[model samples]
Target: METRDFELLIGRNIIEKYRADRHRPAVFALAGLEWDLLDEVWPPTYSPGGELFAGRIPFDRMSSFLEMGCGTGIMSVLAARAGVERVLGLDINPAAVRNTELNARRHAVADRVTARESDLYSAVGPDERFDGIYWNPPFLNAPEDSVDTSIWDETMFDPEYAKLRRFLAEGRELLTPRGKAYLWFGEALGNPALVADLAEETGYDLGVLAKTEMAEIPEALADAFPADLVGGDSEDGEDAAWHLHLLELRPRQA
Candidate 1:
């Protein structure tokens, strides 16, 4: 199927799913950290991308940790628990900010975790730096031509992949001299050209630190995703499940 057709079909599936059941509250553990997340944000149970991202964090504590698009604030709380001196969670949705704050308090990390509403790095201060930064960016490259929109859909759609590239470019600036950045990249959700261009533009070397098998895609979205890209079918049957990879990015040598 064509990319446009595929994107629209995914968009329709997202809208339909959101309208059916948007607010689902659940408790779950990720990378040994317990999370009580509202369905208003991305659910960590069905979605293991966040958990996978949490697992790749360095064992040693850092001075500061920055998390962008902190849906449900799981990573921020986990970062605080990991002994980061300070933790800042940024999200464009006010509800996400509030959710992170609540989660931080619930996890007894409120003292170190600060959640704020910001579109990527816009709200980050000029001089601020972090020893570690993380982002689980919106995956789907869906077009924004649809008339209907909702908060839940934000997790699935990226228009022209603007935010994805912007995050890579601007996020590079927020890293401390010794800081490292990580992003969750699903093979199916991203295009090679965009990824290559972003890496070149930022002058950063992207490396895979870890990977996790993603949950099964809903049957409703089957047609929207290419079977080969999502790893649903193969003669060998080894690549049956989709995988989310943790990418560690750092500046190239001079």
Candidate 2:
């Protein structure tokens, strides 16, 4: 499918799911823990991408961890449970920050996990650094005009990859000498070439750590998606499969 058509389909799926759920608060179970998802916070139950990415984190290798765009603090709490000494979760959405804090407390990891509002690294302390940092970013390249139309848009779209570029550029400064930045990206839905360009421009080497197949249309919005776009058994078929990649970014050697 054409990039524009694919983006439109993703936008439709996001809008339909948001409208159907109306941003209600609910409890969700992930990684055998109950997370209290607050209103207007992105719902992990709506998609398995976050949980799948969270499972890939190497908690045993890190003493301190940071999770960017932490919707419900699932990864932060899980990291603490996995024996990471400290975990910090940051989000641009205040609701998400609060939701993460709620889940941290809910899981009895409040002392070790902290959640705060941040637009990428804005809220991170200059003197502080993490052994591991990761983000499941807003990967879709939505049109500039469609941004900030709703809170849900913040979770789904990153127009022109402005935020993504900053994450790659500015994030390097906040990492420890041996630390690595991990990005959970939807390459099939987003512009992978632009990502590669940005990573190289920012002086980082990008490598794929792991990948998994996810449905192009989220399960909750599967029925709402246009049937015509759903591909079938033909040589020219375009199946509804998208790949989510866990990418490792290391600062380029001198």
In order, the Cα lDDT scores of the candidates are 0.74, 0.79
Off by over 4 Å in 1: 59-61, 147-150, 218-241
**Clashes by residue pair, model 2:** none
Per-residue alpha-carbon lDDT of model 2 for 157-251, expressed as tens digits? 88888889888788888888888888877755677778789989998998888888764566665675567765643346656456778888889
lDDT of 2 at 238: 57
Task: Give the clash count for each candidate.
Answer: 0, 0
Instruction: Give per-model TM-scores.
Output: 0.84, 0.88
Ten consecutive residues with minimal summed lDDT in candidate 1?
A: 220-229
Measure candidate 2: CA RMSD: 2.6
lDDT tens digits, residue span 114-204, model 1: 9888867888988899888888887767667752345655666777777788887777778777778888777655664576678778878
- On lDDT, the candidate that comes out on top is 2
Candidate 1, residue 203: how far the Cα is off, in Å = 0.9
